[model samples]
Target: MEMQPATDSRLELWHELMQFYIREAWLLDERRFREWLDLFTDDVFYFMPRRLNIHRSEPERELSPVGDLAIFEDDKTYLTMRVERLETGMAWGEDPPSRTRHLVGNLVAEPQPGGEVKAKTAFILYRSHHETEENVFAGYRDDVLRPTAGEWKIARRTIVLDSNVILAKNLSVFF
Candidate 1:
Protein backbone atom coordinates (compact mmCIF):
# COMPACT_ATOMS: atom_id res chain seq x y z
CA MET A 1 0.00 0.00 0.00
CA GLU A 2 1.25 3.46 -0.84
CA MET A 3 1.89 5.80 2.09
CA GLN A 4 -0.43 8.79 2.29
CA PRO A 5 0.75 12.26 3.23
CA ALA A 6 -1.14 15.17 4.71
CA THR A 7 -2.14 17.62 2.01
CA ASP A 8 -1.40 21.34 2.29
CA SER A 9 -5.07 22.09 2.71
CA ARG A 10 -5.29 19.51 5.47
CA LEU A 11 -2.38 21.16 7.23
CA GLU A 12 -4.06 24.53 6.95
CA LEU A 13 -7.26 23.07 8.29
CA TRP A 14 -5.34 21.63 11.23
CA HIS A 15 -3.93 25.09 12.05
CA GLU A 16 -7.42 26.54 11.90
CA LEU A 17 -8.52 23.86 14.33
CA MET A 18 -5.74 24.82 16.70
CA GLN A 19 -6.89 28.43 16.58
CA PHE A 20 -10.45 27.28 17.28
CA TYR A 21 -9.32 25.28 20.30
CA ILE A 22 -7.41 28.29 21.59
CA ARG A 23 -10.59 30.31 21.34
CA GLU A 24 -12.37 27.55 23.22
CA ALA A 25 -9.80 27.72 25.99
CA TRP A 26 -10.48 31.39 26.35
CA LEU A 27 -14.22 30.75 26.49
CA LEU A 28 -13.77 28.21 29.24
CA ASP A 29 -11.54 30.55 31.22
CA GLU A 30 -14.21 33.22 30.87
CA ARG A 31 -16.77 30.72 32.23
CA ARG A 32 -18.81 30.82 29.10
CA PHE A 33 -20.10 27.23 29.28
CA ARG A 34 -23.09 27.74 27.03
CA GLU A 35 -21.01 29.19 24.22
CA TRP A 36 -18.40 26.48 24.77
CA LEU A 37 -21.10 23.88 24.39
CA ASP A 38 -21.90 25.29 20.98
CA LEU A 39 -18.49 24.20 19.74
CA PHE A 40 -19.28 20.55 20.35
CA THR A 41 -21.00 18.16 18.02
CA ASP A 42 -24.42 16.84 18.98
CA ASP A 43 -22.89 13.39 19.54
CA VAL A 44 -19.73 14.53 21.25
CA PHE A 45 -17.95 12.15 23.56
CA TYR A 46 -15.97 14.19 26.07
CA PHE A 47 -14.10 12.28 28.76
CA MET A 48 -11.17 12.57 31.14
CA PRO A 49 -9.59 9.39 32.45
CA ARG A 50 -7.95 9.08 35.83
CA ARG A 51 -4.19 9.44 35.85
CA LEU A 52 -2.09 6.61 37.28
CA ASN A 53 1.54 6.79 38.40
CA ILE A 54 3.30 3.60 39.48
CA HIS A 55 6.77 3.27 40.89
CA ARG A 56 9.52 3.08 38.31
CA SER A 57 10.53 -0.36 39.55
CA GLU A 58 7.03 -1.73 39.84
CA PRO A 59 5.46 -3.43 36.88
CA GLU A 60 2.93 -1.33 35.08
CA ARG A 61 -0.66 -2.28 35.67
CA GLU A 62 -3.13 -2.40 32.85
CA LEU A 63 -6.33 -0.39 32.97
CA SER A 64 -9.09 0.54 30.59
CA PRO A 65 -9.50 3.95 28.96
CA VAL A 66 -12.11 6.45 30.08
CA GLY A 67 -14.31 3.42 30.91
CA ASP A 68 -12.53 3.31 34.24
CA LEU A 69 -12.71 6.11 36.77
CA ALA A 70 -12.93 9.43 34.94
CA ILE A 71 -13.21 13.02 35.97
CA PHE A 72 -15.94 13.60 33.41
CA GLU A 73 -17.45 11.19 30.89
CA ASP A 74 -19.96 13.30 29.09
CA ASP A 75 -22.18 13.04 26.10
CA LYS A 76 -24.78 15.71 25.24
CA THR A 77 -26.96 14.32 28.04
CA TYR A 78 -24.20 14.46 30.59
CA LEU A 79 -23.20 17.92 29.45
CA THR A 80 -26.79 19.03 30.03
CA MET A 81 -26.67 17.48 33.49
CA ARG A 82 -23.52 19.44 34.27
CA VAL A 83 -25.16 22.64 33.14
CA GLU A 84 -28.24 21.85 35.21
CA ARG A 85 -26.09 21.23 38.26
CA LEU A 86 -24.33 24.51 37.77
CA GLU A 87 -27.65 26.28 37.46
CA THR A 88 -29.52 24.52 40.27
CA GLY A 89 -28.17 25.69 43.65
CA MET A 90 -27.89 22.03 44.66
CA ALA A 91 -24.43 21.17 43.23
CA TRP A 92 -22.50 21.68 46.44
CA GLY A 93 -19.18 21.55 44.65
CA GLU A 94 -19.86 24.86 43.01
CA ASP A 95 -22.10 26.33 45.67
CA PRO A 96 -19.96 29.47 45.73
CA PRO A 97 -18.71 29.04 42.21
CA SER A 98 -14.94 29.14 42.47
CA ARG A 99 -12.90 31.29 40.12
CA THR A 100 -10.95 29.49 37.43
CA ARG A 101 -8.64 30.15 34.48
CA HIS A 102 -7.70 27.72 31.74
CA LEU A 103 -4.49 28.14 29.72
CA VAL A 104 -4.09 25.96 26.66
CA GLY A 105 -1.02 25.62 24.39
CA ASN A 106 1.41 23.27 22.65
CA LEU A 107 -1.15 22.01 20.19
CA VAL A 108 -0.31 19.17 17.81
CA ALA A 109 -2.57 17.89 15.07
CA GLU A 110 -2.53 14.85 12.84
CA PRO A 111 -4.85 13.89 10.03
CA GLN A 112 -6.94 10.79 10.53
CA PRO A 113 -9.17 8.78 8.27
CA GLY A 114 -12.68 9.86 7.31
CA GLY A 115 -11.78 13.57 7.34
CA GLU A 116 -11.22 13.47 11.08
CA VAL A 117 -8.26 15.08 12.83
CA LYS A 118 -6.61 13.88 16.00
CA ALA A 119 -5.14 16.65 18.10
CA LYS A 120 -3.34 16.97 21.42
CA THR A 121 -3.16 20.06 23.59
CA ALA A 122 -1.34 20.99 26.78
CA PHE A 123 -3.39 22.80 29.41
CA ILE A 124 -2.92 24.45 32.76
CA LEU A 125 -5.98 25.07 34.90
CA TYR A 126 -5.69 27.55 37.74
CA ARG A 127 -8.44 27.83 40.32
CA SER A 128 -8.97 30.03 43.33
CA HIS A 129 -11.27 30.40 46.31
CA HIS A 130 -12.34 33.39 48.35
CA GLU A 131 -9.88 32.85 51.18
CA THR A 132 -7.30 30.65 49.49
CA GLU A 133 -4.70 31.41 46.87
CA GLU A 134 -4.66 29.75 43.47
CA ASN A 135 -4.27 26.06 42.67
CA VAL A 136 -3.02 24.76 39.36
CA PHE A 137 -3.62 21.48 37.53
CA ALA A 138 -1.70 20.73 34.36
CA GLY A 139 -2.63 18.11 31.78
CA TYR A 140 -3.00 17.26 28.11
CA ARG A 141 -5.93 16.32 25.94
CA ASP A 142 -6.19 13.81 23.10
CA ASP A 143 -9.14 14.75 20.96
CA VAL A 144 -10.74 13.75 17.71
CA LEU A 145 -12.42 16.47 15.67
CA ARG A 146 -14.84 15.90 12.84
CA PRO A 147 -16.42 18.25 10.34
CA THR A 148 -20.15 18.61 10.83
CA ALA A 149 -22.51 21.10 9.21
CA GLY A 150 -19.51 22.90 7.65
CA GLU A 151 -17.80 23.34 10.99
CA TRP A 152 -15.38 21.33 13.08
CA LYS A 153 -16.72 19.97 16.33
CA ILE A 154 -15.17 17.81 18.97
CA ALA A 155 -16.15 14.18 18.49
CA ARG A 156 -14.14 12.46 21.20
CA ARG A 157 -11.81 13.84 23.86
CA THR A 158 -9.56 11.98 26.31
CA ILE A 159 -7.78 14.05 28.92
CA VAL A 160 -4.56 12.72 30.48
CA LEU A 161 -3.27 14.50 33.52
CA ASP A 162 0.36 14.72 34.56
CA SER A 163 -0.27 14.28 38.26
CA ASN A 164 -1.83 11.04 39.42
CA VAL A 165 -3.01 12.54 42.67
CA ILE A 166 -5.36 15.51 42.83
CA LEU A 167 -4.80 18.10 45.52
CA ALA A 168 -7.53 20.43 44.45
CA LYS A 169 -10.46 20.46 46.87
CA ASN A 170 -13.14 19.85 44.29
CA LEU A 171 -13.55 19.27 40.55
CA SER A 172 -16.24 21.90 40.39
CA VAL A 173 -14.95 23.94 37.48
CA PHE A 174 -14.91 22.59 33.93
CA PHE A 175 -11.45 21.37 32.99
Candidate 2:
Protein backbone atom coordinates (compact mmCIF):
# COMPACT_ATOMS: atom_id res chain seq x y z
CA MET A 1 0.00 0.00 0.00
CA GLU A 2 1.50 3.29 -1.14
CA MET A 3 0.40 6.86 -0.51
CA GLN A 4 0.60 9.38 -3.33
CA PRO A 5 1.93 12.90 -2.83
CA ALA A 6 -0.41 15.89 -3.18
CA THR A 7 -0.44 17.69 -6.48
CA ASP A 8 1.15 21.16 -6.84
CA SER A 9 -2.25 22.86 -7.10
CA ARG A 10 -3.49 21.15 -3.96
CA LEU A 11 -0.35 22.11 -2.02
CA GLU A 12 -0.63 25.72 -3.16
CA LEU A 13 -4.27 25.86 -2.20
CA TRP A 14 -3.46 24.46 1.23
CA HIS A 15 -0.77 27.05 1.81
CA GLU A 16 -3.05 29.88 0.75
CA LEU A 17 -5.94 28.70 2.93
CA MET A 18 -3.62 28.15 5.90
CA GLN A 19 -2.27 31.66 5.61
CA PHE A 20 -5.81 33.00 5.36
CA TYR A 21 -6.80 31.26 8.58
CA ILE A 22 -3.65 32.51 10.36
CA ARG A 23 -4.33 36.10 9.42
CA GLU A 24 -7.99 35.81 10.41
CA ALA A 25 -7.00 34.46 13.81
CA TRP A 26 -4.46 37.26 14.26
CA LEU A 27 -7.13 39.86 13.50
CA LEU A 28 -9.53 38.35 16.01
CA ASP A 29 -6.89 38.04 18.73
CA GLU A 30 -5.96 41.68 18.27
CA ARG A 31 -9.63 42.64 18.61
CA ARG A 32 -9.59 44.15 15.19
CA PHE A 33 -13.29 43.55 14.56
CA ARG A 34 -13.68 45.76 11.52
CA GLU A 35 -10.58 44.33 9.91
CA TRP A 36 -11.78 40.83 10.63
CA LEU A 37 -15.14 41.59 9.04
CA ASP A 38 -13.33 42.43 5.81
CA LEU A 39 -12.25 38.81 5.50
CA PHE A 40 -15.83 37.67 5.05
CA THR A 41 -17.95 38.04 1.97
CA ASP A 42 -20.95 40.36 1.81
CA ASP A 43 -23.29 37.38 1.79
CA VAL A 44 -21.50 35.25 4.34
CA PHE A 45 -23.43 32.90 6.56
CA TYR A 46 -22.04 32.33 10.04
CA PHE A 47 -23.76 29.66 12.07
CA MET A 48 -23.33 27.53 15.18
CA PRO A 49 -26.07 25.04 15.74
CA ARG A 50 -27.17 24.00 19.19
CA ARG A 51 -26.25 20.59 20.57
CA LEU A 52 -28.08 18.36 23.04
CA ASN A 53 -27.46 15.16 24.91
CA ILE A 54 -29.24 12.37 23.11
CA HIS A 55 -29.55 8.63 23.47
CA ARG A 56 -26.94 6.47 21.71
CA SER A 57 -29.62 5.09 19.42
CA GLU A 58 -30.47 8.60 18.14
CA PRO A 59 -27.08 9.91 17.02
CA GLU A 60 -28.51 12.35 14.47
CA ARG A 61 -30.60 14.08 17.12
CA GLU A 62 -27.53 15.21 19.05
CA LEU A 63 -27.06 18.39 17.05
CA SER A 64 -29.78 20.72 15.85
CA PRO A 65 -30.12 21.34 12.14
CA VAL A 66 -29.66 24.66 10.36
CA GLY A 67 -32.61 27.12 10.59
CA ASP A 68 -33.56 25.39 13.82
CA LEU A 69 -32.52 26.34 17.35
CA ALA A 70 -28.94 27.56 16.95
CA ILE A 71 -26.47 29.15 19.28
CA PHE A 72 -25.64 31.54 16.44
CA GLU A 73 -27.01 31.94 12.96
CA ASP A 74 -25.81 35.27 11.76
CA ASP A 75 -25.72 36.40 8.20
CA LYS A 76 -23.31 39.13 7.04
CA THR A 77 -25.75 41.87 7.92
CA TYR A 78 -26.24 40.55 11.41
CA LEU A 79 -22.52 40.03 11.84
CA THR A 80 -21.85 43.63 10.83
CA MET A 81 -24.46 44.86 13.27
CA ARG A 82 -22.83 42.86 16.05
CA VAL A 83 -19.48 44.39 15.22
CA GLU A 84 -20.98 47.86 15.20
CA ARG A 85 -22.50 47.29 18.60
CA LEU A 86 -19.15 46.20 19.95
CA GLU A 87 -17.47 49.24 18.43
CA THR A 88 -19.72 51.51 20.41
CA GLY A 89 -18.99 52.08 24.11
CA MET A 90 -22.33 50.67 25.27
CA ALA A 91 -22.07 46.92 24.84
CA TRP A 92 -22.38 45.82 28.49
CA GLY A 93 -20.81 42.41 28.31
CA GLU A 94 -17.80 43.72 26.39
CA ASP A 95 -17.24 46.89 28.40
CA PRO A 96 -13.77 45.75 29.39
CA PRO A 97 -13.11 43.92 26.13
CA SER A 98 -11.89 40.39 26.66
CA ARG A 99 -8.48 39.22 25.50
CA THR A 100 -8.61 36.25 23.17
CA ARG A 101 -6.36 33.76 21.40
CA HIS A 102 -7.83 31.81 18.50
CA LEU A 103 -5.95 28.76 17.30
CA VAL A 104 -6.87 27.04 14.01
CA GLY A 105 -5.38 23.78 12.80
CA ASN A 106 -5.92 20.46 11.01
CA LEU A 107 -7.04 22.05 7.78
CA VAL A 108 -8.65 19.86 5.15
CA ALA A 109 -9.68 21.60 1.91
CA GLU A 110 -11.37 20.48 -1.25
CA PRO A 111 -12.09 22.44 -4.38
CA GLN A 112 -15.71 23.20 -5.10
CA PRO A 113 -17.40 24.39 -8.25
CA GLY A 114 -17.03 28.03 -9.37
CA GLY A 115 -13.65 28.82 -7.82
CA GLU A 116 -14.57 27.95 -4.28
CA VAL A 117 -12.88 25.83 -1.68
CA LYS A 118 -14.67 24.00 1.11
CA ALA A 119 -12.34 23.62 4.08
CA LYS A 120 -12.62 22.34 7.62
CA THR A 121 -10.36 23.03 10.58
CA ALA A 122 -10.24 22.36 14.29
CA PHE A 123 -10.08 25.46 16.50
CA ILE A 124 -9.58 26.42 20.11
CA LEU A 125 -10.75 29.85 21.23
CA TYR A 126 -9.63 31.10 24.64
CA ARG A 127 -11.07 34.25 26.17
CA SER A 128 -10.01 36.00 29.34
CA HIS A 129 -11.86 38.87 30.97
CA HIS A 130 -11.30 41.12 33.97
CA GLU A 131 -9.71 39.41 36.96
CA THR A 132 -11.63 36.16 37.38
CA GLU A 133 -13.48 35.40 34.16
CA GLU A 134 -12.21 32.96 31.60
CA ASN A 135 -13.66 30.78 28.88
CA VAL A 136 -12.31 28.19 26.47
CA PHE A 137 -14.15 26.80 23.47
CA ALA A 138 -13.05 24.03 21.13
CA GLY A 139 -14.76 23.45 17.81
CA TYR A 140 -14.46 22.51 14.18
CA ARG A 141 -15.31 25.06 11.47
CA ASP A 142 -16.71 24.00 8.13
CA ASP A 143 -16.02 26.91 5.80
CA VAL A 144 -16.74 27.67 2.22
CA LEU A 145 -14.09 30.08 0.98
CA ARG A 146 -14.73 31.93 -2.23
CA PRO A 147 -12.10 33.62 -4.37
CA THR A 148 -12.80 37.30 -4.73
CA ALA A 149 -10.52 39.96 -6.24
CA GLY A 150 -7.34 37.87 -5.94
CA GLU A 151 -8.08 36.93 -2.36
CA TRP A 152 -10.15 34.40 -0.50
CA LYS A 153 -13.21 35.46 1.47
CA ILE A 154 -15.22 33.31 3.85
CA ALA A 155 -18.63 32.91 2.26
CA ARG A 156 -19.88 30.45 4.85
CA ARG A 157 -18.76 29.23 8.28
CA THR A 158 -20.47 26.60 10.40
CA ILE A 159 -18.98 26.19 13.86
CA VAL A 160 -19.62 22.93 15.66
CA LEU A 161 -18.63 23.43 19.30
CA ASP A 162 -17.56 20.39 21.29
CA SER A 163 -19.58 21.30 24.38
CA ASN A 164 -23.31 20.69 24.64
CA VAL A 165 -23.70 23.39 27.25
CA ILE A 166 -21.86 26.72 27.35
CA LEU A 167 -20.20 27.54 30.65
CA ALA A 168 -19.28 31.08 29.69
CA LYS A 169 -21.32 33.94 31.10
CA ASN A 170 -21.44 35.61 27.75
CA LEU A 171 -20.49 34.65 24.21
CA SER A 172 -19.43 38.16 23.28
CA VAL A 173 -16.15 37.16 21.72
CA PHE A 174 -16.23 35.93 18.11
CA PHE A 175 -15.10 32.36 17.35
Candidate 3:
Protein backbone atom coordinates (compact mmCIF):
# COMPACT_ATOMS: atom_id res chain seq x y z
CA MET A 1 0.00 0.00 0.00
CA GLU A 2 1.10 3.51 -0.72
CA MET A 3 1.10 6.37 1.77
CA GLN A 4 -0.56 9.63 0.94
CA PRO A 5 1.55 12.74 0.67
CA ALA A 6 1.58 14.79 3.85
CA THR A 7 -0.61 17.89 3.84
CA ASP A 8 0.83 21.36 4.46
CA SER A 9 0.00 21.19 8.15
CA ARG A 10 1.33 17.68 8.28
CA LEU A 11 4.54 18.85 6.64
CA GLU A 12 5.10 21.17 9.58
CA LEU A 13 4.48 18.25 11.87
CA TRP A 14 7.00 16.21 9.91
CA HIS A 15 9.62 18.89 10.39
CA GLU A 16 8.99 18.83 14.11
CA LEU A 17 9.34 15.07 14.13
CA MET A 18 12.62 15.29 12.27
CA GLN A 19 13.90 17.81 14.76
CA PHE A 20 12.81 15.51 17.52
CA TYR A 21 14.94 12.71 16.08
CA ILE A 22 17.92 15.03 15.74
CA ARG A 23 17.58 16.05 19.36
CA GLU A 24 17.26 12.45 20.38
CA ALA A 25 20.54 11.59 18.69
CA TRP A 26 22.21 14.55 20.31
CA LEU A 27 21.01 13.51 23.75
CA LEU A 28 22.30 9.98 23.36
CA ASP A 29 25.66 11.17 22.08
CA GLU A 30 25.98 13.53 25.03
CA ARG A 31 25.14 10.73 27.47
CA ARG A 32 22.11 12.63 28.68
CA PHE A 33 20.38 9.41 29.66
CA ARG A 34 17.90 11.04 31.99
CA GLU A 35 16.68 13.51 29.38
CA TRP A 36 16.65 10.82 26.72
CA LEU A 37 14.44 8.71 28.96
CA ASP A 38 11.97 11.57 29.12
CA LEU A 39 11.46 11.43 25.37
CA PHE A 40 9.71 8.09 25.67
CA THR A 41 6.14 7.53 26.75
CA ASP A 42 5.39 5.65 29.91
CA ASP A 43 4.45 2.51 27.99
CA VAL A 44 7.23 2.64 25.43
CA PHE A 45 8.32 -0.58 23.76
CA TYR A 46 11.93 -0.39 22.65
CA PHE A 47 13.46 -3.43 21.02
CA MET A 48 16.28 -4.52 18.80
CA PRO A 49 15.56 -7.86 17.24
CA ARG A 50 18.27 -10.18 15.97
CA ARG A 51 18.83 -10.17 12.22
CA LEU A 52 19.87 -13.32 10.40
CA ASN A 53 21.19 -13.92 6.92
CA ILE A 54 19.13 -16.50 5.17
CA HIS A 55 19.31 -17.73 1.62
CA ARG A 56 17.33 -15.60 -0.80
CA SER A 57 15.08 -18.55 -1.37
CA GLU A 58 14.33 -18.84 2.33
CA PRO A 59 13.24 -15.32 3.02
CA GLU A 60 11.03 -16.38 5.86
CA ARG A 61 14.05 -17.35 7.96
CA GLU A 62 15.10 -13.79 8.55
CA LEU A 63 14.62 -11.31 11.36
CA SER A 64 12.86 -12.48 14.50
CA PRO A 65 11.94 -10.45 17.59
CA VAL A 66 10.25 -13.31 19.41
CA GLY A 67 11.65 -16.73 18.55
CA ASP A 68 15.26 -15.50 18.23
CA LEU A 69 17.50 -13.81 20.71
CA ALA A 70 17.49 -10.03 20.94
CA ILE A 71 20.04 -7.51 22.09
CA PHE A 72 17.25 -5.63 23.85
CA GLU A 73 13.50 -5.92 24.32
CA ASP A 74 12.93 -3.34 26.96
CA ASP A 75 9.86 -1.57 28.23
CA LYS A 76 9.86 1.83 29.90
CA THR A 77 10.62 0.34 33.33
CA TYR A 78 13.53 -1.67 31.97
CA LEU A 79 14.88 1.41 30.22
CA THR A 80 14.56 3.39 33.45
CA MET A 81 16.58 0.76 35.28
CA ARG A 82 19.28 0.95 32.64
CA VAL A 83 19.43 4.71 32.99
CA GLU A 84 19.69 4.37 36.78
CA ARG A 85 22.52 1.88 36.39
CA LEU A 86 24.38 4.21 34.08
CA GLU A 87 23.85 7.07 36.50
CA THR A 88 25.42 5.04 39.33
CA GLY A 89 28.70 4.93 37.38
CA MET A 90 28.91 1.22 38.09
CA ALA A 91 27.93 -0.10 34.67
CA TRP A 92 31.43 -1.13 33.66
CA GLY A 93 30.54 -1.04 30.01
CA GLU A 94 29.97 2.68 30.33
CA ASP A 95 32.01 3.70 33.36
CA PRO A 96 34.69 5.23 31.17
CA PRO A 97 31.98 6.44 28.83
CA SER A 98 32.72 5.89 25.18
CA ARG A 99 32.71 8.88 22.87
CA THR A 100 29.87 8.51 20.40
CA ARG A 101 28.36 10.36 17.46
CA HIS A 102 24.90 9.55 16.16
CA LEU A 103 24.01 10.49 12.60
CA VAL A 104 20.35 10.22 11.70
CA GLY A 105 18.83 10.84 8.27
CA ASN A 106 16.49 9.66 5.56
CA LEU A 107 13.45 10.32 7.68
CA VAL A 108 9.98 9.57 6.37
CA ALA A 109 6.93 10.27 8.44
CA GLU A 110 3.32 9.44 7.85
CA PRO A 111 0.39 10.60 9.88
CA GLN A 112 -1.46 7.75 11.48
CA PRO A 113 -4.76 7.34 13.23
CA GLY A 114 -5.17 8.66 16.77
CA GLY A 115 -2.98 11.70 16.08
CA GLU A 116 0.17 9.59 15.99
CA VAL A 117 2.94 9.43 13.42
CA LYS A 118 4.80 6.45 12.01
CA ALA A 119 8.34 7.25 11.04
CA LYS A 120 11.33 5.46 9.57
CA THR A 121 14.90 6.62 9.49
CA ALA A 122 18.45 5.41 8.98
CA PHE A 123 21.22 5.87 11.54
CA ILE A 124 24.96 5.48 11.69
CA LEU A 125 26.66 5.45 15.08
CA TYR A 126 30.40 5.89 15.62
CA ARG A 127 31.84 4.99 18.98
CA SER A 128 35.39 5.18 20.30
CA HIS A 129 36.20 3.70 23.67
CA HIS A 130 39.39 4.14 25.63
CA GLU A 131 42.18 2.29 23.73
CA THR A 132 40.11 0.57 21.12
CA GLU A 133 39.42 0.95 17.44
CA GLU A 134 36.28 2.87 16.63
CA ASN A 135 33.16 0.75 16.43
CA VAL A 136 30.62 1.64 13.75
CA PHE A 137 27.00 0.56 13.72
CA ALA A 138 24.50 1.35 10.99
CA GLY A 139 20.81 0.60 11.15
CA TYR A 140 17.29 1.62 10.31
CA ARG A 141 14.66 2.44 12.86
CA ASP A 142 10.87 2.17 12.73
CA ASP A 143 8.99 4.17 15.30
CA VAL A 144 5.53 5.12 16.37
CA LEU A 145 5.30 8.58 17.87
CA ARG A 146 2.39 9.91 19.83
CA PRO A 147 1.58 13.58 20.33
CA THR A 148 0.95 14.23 23.99
CA ALA A 149 0.14 17.64 25.45
CA GLY A 150 1.42 19.38 22.32
CA GLU A 151 4.72 17.46 22.37
CA TRP A 152 5.84 14.36 20.54
CA LYS A 153 6.81 11.25 22.47
CA ILE A 154 8.02 7.88 21.32
CA ALA A 155 5.52 5.10 21.88
CA ARG A 156 7.49 2.33 20.24
CA ARG A 157 10.80 1.85 18.48
CA THR A 158 12.23 -1.14 16.66
CA ILE A 159 15.86 -1.03 15.61
CA VAL A 160 16.94 -3.21 12.72
CA LEU A 161 20.72 -3.31 12.57
CA ASP A 162 22.54 -3.88 9.32
CA SER A 163 24.97 -6.41 10.71
CA ASN A 164 23.96 -10.00 11.20
CA VAL A 165 26.70 -10.44 13.79
CA ILE A 166 27.77 -7.48 15.88
CA LEU A 167 31.51 -7.06 16.40
CA ALA A 168 31.28 -4.79 19.45
CA LYS A 169 32.02 -6.44 22.78
CA ASN A 170 28.90 -5.00 24.33
CA LEU A 171 25.79 -3.28 22.93
CA SER A 172 25.31 -0.93 25.86
CA VAL A 173 24.57 2.33 24.10
CA PHE A 174 21.11 3.28 22.98
CA PHE A 175 20.63 3.28 19.21
Q: What lDDT tens digits, residue by residue, belong to model 1 across residues 1-175? A: 1233678886687579878987897887777788888877889888877666766675344223655777778898888788777777787777677787788877778778798888888999888876775688898888888889888888888876677678876676776
What candidate 3 gets wrong by more than 4 Å, as runs, is 1-6
TM-score of each: 0.84, 0.94, 0.93
- 2 against 3, candidate with superior TM-score: 2
Cα lDDT tens digits for candidate 3, 20-135: 99999999998998999999999999989888998899776677856467778899999999899988878898889889999999888888878888899999999998787679
For model 2, the superposed segments whose C-alpha errors exceed 4 Å read 1-5
Candidate 3 local lDDT, residue 60: 69
Q: How high is the lDDT of residue 64 in model 2?
A: 94
lDDT of 2 by residue, 16-42 (tens): 899999999999998899999999999
Clashing pairs in 3: none
Q: Which pairs clash in the backbone of model 1?
A: none
Give the residue spans of candidate 1 off by over 4 A: 1-11, 55-64, 89-92
> What is the alpha-carbon lDDT of model 3 when measured against the actual structure?
0.88
Query: Of the pair 1 and 2, which is ahead by lDDT?
Result: 2
**C-alpha displacement of 98 in model 2, angstroms?**
0.6
Per-model RMSD to reference: 3.5, 2.4, 1.6
